[model samples]
Target: MKFNWEGVMPAVTTKFTKDDKLDLKMFQTNIKAQVDAGVHGIVLGGTLGEASTLLESEKRQLTKSTLEVVEGKIPVLMNIAEQSTKGAIYAAQQAQQDGASGLMILPPMRYKSGDRETVTYFKEVAKNTDLPIMIYNNPVDYKIEVTLDMFDEMLECKNIQAVKESTRDTTNITRIINKFGTRLKIMTGVDTIALESLLMGADGWVAGLVCAFPAETVAIYELQKAGRIKEAIEIYRWFLPLLELDINPKLVQNIKLAEVYTNIGTENVRAPRLPLFGDERKNVIQIIESSLKTRPTLPAYKNL
Candidate 1:
């Protein structure tokens, strides 16, 4: 099925219990809240969801719970990234069966490899399912960059459709738009450059901060879509500092804490990934609190 993918697809956080178990109830509540707030889609199992730390079972459960909450109201894109091609394909097929609208596949991690290896990896995974696939290009995390040429090659797969452009370079965004705008649906994965990406002809944004502030994120996109540039910039300036905080190494910790402070989701995160503590923790708290205090009044939630 060809789905029209667009707008503020949050790389949602997976809510965990205090002991770091997957908190399914909290996860459902969070997804329900985003759907109610009118986001275009929910992107579970992505970087912000802490997908790397989740087990295969947990990934399946998250997709199941998300399907229940969203109730077919909006599209769901599951991020299936693993060190092994087989694992990624397994996860993608499971998510597709569980009613996910599409799969966002990341390059295999843990081994430093060349472009041919990376292309082979994605091709293997793509062959496994008929679900629409979005190539997630985040070079910083995966240590592999899928260039424009590689993207063109992948487009021949037909089911390999959209792209989540996470690189912070607008030039690359322009290059992709210039080359493949007609063939692919490009979405900005970087929160800071989301507006610029949209202005440069990207179809939508896959934002991380939308987990904390969905209304504001949606407003920015809607305003831009309506050609209300001045108004969108005004909201963007107010929210940019909070978006900046998301680019830190301690992002998951900060985002979870912000969710807790906003009474949206739990502050719990799994280990190997720990909560922010001491001065580092304090600095994130201070920034979020300050943002909340200075946070511009979004139009009535009804107006949104």
Candidate 2:
């Protein structure tokens, strides 16, 4: 299948075994489920996938494995979030070499660069690659906003194909559209406001909680796109609680917790990250349980 920077694409979580190794089988299973559920694409090794802790070899393995299972049924987008421009270029080259469909590239990780530095870093990587790129801009957490002016400068780099708008501000969606029109394909990166962003004319979604509720995610996107706003909101209202998990700091744990119910992925994570326990665990599960009890059937859109 051909991939545009549009529709419902998931930033899937990286799965780990109880022994703390990459659970490639489970990872592929999760990606397969995403495609099977009609997601427009799959984004691997992103923040949800814990890119910082993954070994270079492991990341490549993920890219290779993801492409195989997806089998070109949908675009398999690999995330490159390295801290150095040189490092990012190398990762992009590796993905291109392995036949990845595209990449979701973050600004230089760790050390927050100012606007000039950020634009330069993105351009440097884009100059060296033929693969399409999605600029991952989450100013709220990354502390380095990829401002519209910086994007104006970034226009010189031809491979900068899309924007993952996760500033946690809905107005930015309209602002981008007003500024550039279709110059940049905009993907809603925040889960909580995904419906609003889609309604505001974002071209796609790079969602985290979709790992658990892939069908619902795709349904909401399709329903909204088809102009069945009322039906889409009906599902969105039921999904909002679980969707809220994606915006929090414990997102990895929270999402995996929801995944456990789906039984496609596990809750295990690397050190500095652990399973949710105590009140936190109970609180998230309670929300998931409450929602499950009243889970809505998909809106039955034939286009799906």
Candidate 3:
């Protein structure tokens, strides 16, 4: 299957039981919601999915459940953010065996390795797995950026075919196109600047807020591709406030709250993370409720 790294692929959050066990049933329920909403694909075990806090078994269960729910209707890409190169390779191979269509891999987390180490790490993992890979380059959040020079070293690994461009600087989207062209699929990883990235010719969006506002996200992308900027901006302006929730260290909690408000998923994130309370909770809830009160109607896509 040729995976077109276009449209919205929500890095779905991991719903947990109160005891912090992987709530596979609720997880499946959330995944089905994304598919039914017409998202191009759904990503599991992502940064928003709280991958850093999940155990190995929980991660596998999440991916397996995602594959079962999606049933090949769309690509089920899993996030692989292991701290070691060998660990990343092993996880990548295991995910392919588990039926994931692709992977969104980050640089060796917590290491802050130099360019040579980062390049070698990604190349090794890409070579070991047959599934397509999207290199996650979010220096703002993860503190590691997959620079274009590093990408030049990656041309040897053809499977490393996509980049989640979260540099937070919009021009990097253009920079990637100027240098690599179609060799890499550029997905706007940061939510707030997603519309801008799409206008700059981003191939797709590995979105966070889309988990809550899927229809709006897809509509903005469709309208933009159809050359309807004024229309897209109208929605983008409305969505910007909610989209701002996709950034920062507490994004998992913030996005999970969005899911709760939309009733697509629960906000039961695991430990080391807790539900928002008091002013923080009220502030986010206020924003989401206000947006819901005036949500935009989605126009039909060309094909549909």
Candidate 3: clashing pairs of residues: none
Query: Who wins the TM-score comparison?
Result: 2
**Predicted candidate 3 versus true structure: per-residue lDDT over 1-304, tens digit per residue:** 3678998999989989888788888778778888887888888888888888988888888888888888888998889999899999999998888888999999998889998999999999988988989998988777777888999999788898999998989999989999988988899988899999999999989998988878888888888988988888999999998999887677888888988888888889888789998999899999899998989877775354
Every model: Cα RMSD to truth: 1.6, 1.4, 1.3
Model 2, 192-271: lDDT tens digits are: 89999999989999988899999999999999999899999999999999998987889999999899998889999999
* Candidate 1 local lDDT, 1-304, one digit each (tens): 6777687788999999887789999888778778877798888887789988888788889888988888888888899878788788888788878878888888887887688888888888888888888899988767788998888777778888888888788778778878887678888888888898898888899987888888888888888887888888999998988898788887888888888877788888888888888998888888889989988776543353
Q: What TM-score against the true fold does each predicted structure earn?
A: 0.96, 0.97, 0.96
Give the winner by TM-score: 1 or 2. Answer: 2
Q: What is the lDDT, from 0 to 100, of the residue 121 in candidate 1?
A: 82
Taking all chains together, the TM-score of candidate 3 against the true structure is: 0.96
lDDT of each: 0.84, 0.89, 0.87
On lDDT, the candidate that comes out on top is 2
Colliding residue pairs in candidate 2? none
